[model samples]
Target: MTTAGGRPPRRLRADARDNRDQLLAAARAEFTEQGTHASLNKIAQRAGVGAGTLYRHFPTLAALLAALIGDDVDALCATGRDLMTHPDPDEALAVWLHAVAVHATAMRGLVATQMAALRDRRTAGALAACHDAIRAAGVALLDRAHHHGSAPAHVDIADLLTLVNAAAWASEQAPDDAALLARLLALITAGLRA
Candidate 1:
């Protein structure tokens, strides 16, 4: 493959397309079963491709790892944007938090290099874009709720939405993540109440 501007080289040929998809499937399964040590050779074999072919598609282990997690991250962020079209901001926020929890848990298993890239991205401009979008949605809904006397005057919409994601991350680390999240929502809404 060739590249410029961080895109995968030109359009993949049919054979290359099959190889790439196969590699992704193999890698996902291997990572799930064997954690980060899922060998490249094993993945290549599972995908019915040679190690050289895997390396050709992904020059390094980090490249492959980044590709896997990066695709998912892009999708998750897109979902955050799409949630704006939902009529209910609070419900949208809840769903976004849940999606983040799931994606975070899955990405946590990525190789160290890939994880660092993901971490760095959150500290960059992407974080601000995501945060602002969420806050805007929350403020709109919360303001309406306040007009109806269902939201507290002093509640900080920005801070509350931020806290929700932080709590969601913590919930992701727990064994009973679903139960933990249910409790978290109860506690948060209790505090955020009108």
Candidate 2:
């Protein structure tokens, strides 16, 4: 089966596959609980695998995070596909932007990792593919909204994404104040409307 980015799955032996899967599961838990700074050794221990095995599978924290979040990006693309069919273009764009914000802030420090991966040449291909997929999704939504004349002609997809990213970053800082985030997003959405 192909992975999230349509890359062919690595042909791993049964034991190796098991190790990789365990490592991913453990890493997800550890990262979620401790942020991106979580210890790799603890992750390896949690997975019941040796440090060597973890290193063999994922040489760097960025690689592990990229693998883990690729699935989320794919799901975001699926959300965009579904939003395309919604009857109201403006509402669809608004909802999709909200989804993007949620995805960005789902894990602490994910936005930073994503930004880093976008800049780092070595890991850029996979992460850029995911980023581009999300941008394409946003572009589709923006086009629909523009065609419907609900969104301002001056609005650009990249600008919209940047706005959402900023809101997501704010949400990360004050996670308990979800109402504030919603209000801020609503204000931004309102500004986009014609």
User: Model 2: per-residue lDDT, tens digit, 23-120?
Assistant: 99998888778775689999999999999999999987667777878898889899999999999999999999988888877567664456545755
Candidate topping lDDT: 2
Per-residue lDDT over 1-194 for candidate 1, one digit per residue giving the tens place of the 0 to 100 score: 44557777688899999999999999988886776567889999999999999999888766676567666666766776777666765566556656654554463344322333443544434433443443464566566545553456787765665566556556656866568866886677656553
Model-by-model lDDT, in order?
0.64, 0.83
- At residue 66, candidate 2 shows an lDDT of 70
Badly placed stretches (over 4 Å) of model 2 are 1-10, 116-123
Q: Clash number for model 2?
A: 0
Highest TM-score against the true fold, candidate: 2
Stretch of 10 with least lDDT, candidate 2: 111-120
